[model samples]
Target: MDNNSCGCNVCSTREDLPWEGRGTDLPIAGCRFTLYPMTDRYVDIILGSLEKTDTSYVWSETDALSTVYRGKLPYVADAVKALFVNAYRSGVHMALEGQFSKGCPGDIAGDSLLEKDGEAPNAKSAEGIHFPVKCKLALYPMGVGNYIDDIAKVWYMAQDRGLEPTTIHYATRISGDVHDVFDYLRDVCALMDESAVSHYILHFTVNCNSPTKE
Candidate 1:
């Protein structure tokens, strides 16, 4: 195989491709996120965070909208957490909007990433960094017949964890330490089963140091 070749469902030259033999059961994950820093120094904050965070385990790209990370789930999650924490500035309201996806039928470009493995390198260093955050998230478990029931179960799960989420239009709001929010999200993502969902996406926004008077 050439270094540039992609052995995915759409490009594989092999007769017995995995997807054809069984199915497209890759564990590839991705995250696209944009950070909004509430200050004139926003550019510095965004760039600085990118510099400090370690994204070596993942394939990453940045454009006008947001930074996209594609790789194993742990690397994708840890990269997001480390970047957000690195960008934290006290008294400056910062917002990060992100979309995390797994098992998407169209996501074949990063299939090679599955061969790469190990713990997220930056996760250890970013541990124990605490900050308050308010977040809103919408979870979609695709192709499930009773999606509302699954969604409701997540709501109840959050309540059980003592992270009572407030119902808002199009999303649910949860307030807590940054670590807790991320942990909750990890669990939420884990709730999806391969046999049930064709694809799953979690759209969320985390805000810290907001100046909102409410």
Candidate 2:
């Protein structure tokens, strides 16, 4: 009858969650990803890598299908990238499928969207103002994967063009000029198509708006 040994979801505790008592008040971003291992070694590598993450992030593991991270935009991005880097370093072929969001159209608890302070910004505000752009991305065969190289290329392309890109888990959020944002996305899709391996599937979505926007 002990809850700890019962393995019941209902008996599980979320009181330790970073946002447990805090309502969705802070402007934050989040992402969820399913890590697919080409080999069983991925589990250890992932767990080891996670233990090494130094940032303060709200992470939740759901069985074996996926894990979610929530925090400020930069922290979330860093944690995701750190995990990916460790997985790659382990030399295991892996794939990640996930969604990223910031300022989307729904309640944070229900939609997994990033929290924002106000409504969506206008064109005038957008001109000089930077905003979050949620994106979904998948990369397969992690170590020496074709998709990895292509993604690196796109990342550099964004930087070279003066865009602010934050990678969250398997997804990314890029903020900058709207034209630059779309252009980066266009190039990413093109590169993925051009460099994808036979065993890979690349899928993603880009949502550009504050999650709290009306």
Summed over model 1, clashes come to 0
For residues 1-214, what per-residue lDDT tens digits would candidate 2 score against the true structure? 2212122243245455443333343344555666555666766867776665443444445556667766544445445544544444333345455554432222244433344323222222223433334444543322233445666776677667776666888655555543355445435434543553212223454434333443
Local distance difference test scores for all models: 0.80, 0.47
The numbered model that scores best in lDDT is 1
Question: Can you write out model 1's per-residue Cα lDDT over 76-178, one digit (the tens) per residue?
Answer: 8888989999999888899999988876654565433656676778878888689999999999886556789878978987888878799999999998988
Per-candidate TM-scores read 0.84, 0.41
Model 1: runs farther than 4 Å from truth? Answer: 1-24
- Mark the regions of model 2 whose C-alpha exceeds 4 Å error after superposition: 1-25, 109-214
Q: Residue 115 of candidate 1: its Cα lDDT?
A: 66
